[model samples]
Target: MCGTCGCGEEGTVSIRKPGEDTGEHTHSHSHAHDHQGHAHEHSHQHKHAHSHAHEGHQQHHESSHGHEHGGNGHHHRHEREIQLEIDVMQKNNLLAERNRGYFEAKQILALNLVSSPGSGKTSLLEKTIKDFKSQKKIYIIEGDQQTMNDADRIEKAGAPVVQVNTGSGCHLDADMINKAVKILEVEDHSLLFIENVGNLVCPSLFNLGEQKRVVIVSTTEGEDKPIKYPNMFQSSDVCIINKTDLLPYLDFDLEKMKEYALRVNHQLEFIEISVKNGEGLNKWYAWLKNLSL
Candidate 1:
């Protein structure tokens, strides 16, 4: 299971391209599955401690202070759990730094786009890919819990794409991005967009070595989403308010959403866009162009 979200299990994650053999997929459980190994090691140590305890069992029966050690044991277990979480995050950060270094050396403009489901993330990508493909060499790493539907759409949009179906994984980790980049053979001096799984929570915790993290929230979702999921907004570098075309039909407050987002992340750059009608897309394209410059 993922230590951060506890959504994925051993052998539950897989990375593959579209139309590839489903039987030939990568089993990636390196994140939280390492806890199982740690547990085994602890168990082995416990057996030795058990033997020692058995040797001292007679002394405990004769002593009146045997219960005093119980509190210490509970404290030690709590510390171990805290340490385990630290270990998981530390390991992820180390890999993320390595991926960041590689991107820097290659001058690859990698952007991690994150959002909740049905936030028009894929649609924004499709529009961006179609509009910018002619000027820049673009590549995509599409992430989802299951299915290659987004990947297929990206492939048709005219960019080299790799689909990572994370089975039960809630978010894409640095290790997954490292592996996907190798498979995609991403070119240097090009655009690499990692469309993270449609999740607001766990995806914000894992850094995929992207140069910028863009969070997309639609107007249809409540204006209070920024405060509700502050971590996602706080960690994001850019906030894309997508699906602006539907504003007239719904009871959505555009200014209130921006106000809430600013409260969470004052540095977050906002781009209002409606992929359906090409509203504010030039600004979006301009932002992407400025990144490459």
Candidate 2:
């Protein structure tokens, strides 16, 4: 399982290129059903550490105080797990720094856009690409658990794209981005948008070496989302309050949401936009354009 979220890792985080057949792809998990309000923990991502059979095996040892090392009891295992978690995160941070250096060298403006499911991230991306595709070289890395649907939409929007299906994993860590970047072969002086998996909680703990982390929150979601999921709001460099066209029909308080977000992140840049009607999108586009300069 992915050490980041404790979800089963049997799912494939495969990179799918446009025009390639997906018939050969097979996975053990699909759909976003894994993230059901569980507090995401350190995913001890070592290959041999955990297995599905471990569940059945663990049930057999109620006490679990094996005498393999002279009855060290559960305390030894707990300490070891904590150490391993630290080690894994250290390794991920190191790799993320490497990715940052690579992007700096290539002059690539990489933005990591994160949000909850159905936050209109893809819609915003489509509009962003359409707005600047002719003047800029844009590449996309789409992350999901099971399908290439988002990547297909992005490809139709006139940009080179790669989809990384994270199977059951709730979030995409830096190692995933490191591999995805190699597959994208992103050019110099271009923009790389990594549309991370639709998760608000687990994705916050891991940094994918992005130049900016843009978190999108729709008007349909509660204004208290910032307080409920403060980590993402605090970590994000920019927060886009999307779907402003629905604001008239919804009861969401725009100013209240901004207040909550600012409470968590005083310096978070905000851009309110509606991809449906082109309202406030110019500012969003300009924000992106200035980042490259």
Q: lDDT of each prediction vs. the true structure?
A: 0.84, 0.82
TM-score between model 1 and native:
0.80
Q: Determine the C-alpha RMSD for candidate 1 after optimal superposition of all C-alphas.
A: 5.7
Overlapping backbone residue pairs in candidate 1 total 0
Expressed as tens digits, the lDDT of each residue in 103-192 for candidate 1 is 999889999999999999888889898899887899999999888899999988888888887777788999888988888888889999
Any idea what lDDT model 2 has?
A: 0.82
Error of 2 at 212 (Å): 0.7
After TM-score superposition, the amount by which residue 99's alpha carbon in candidate 2 deviates from its true location, in angstroms, is 0.7
Error of 1 at 50 (Å): 17
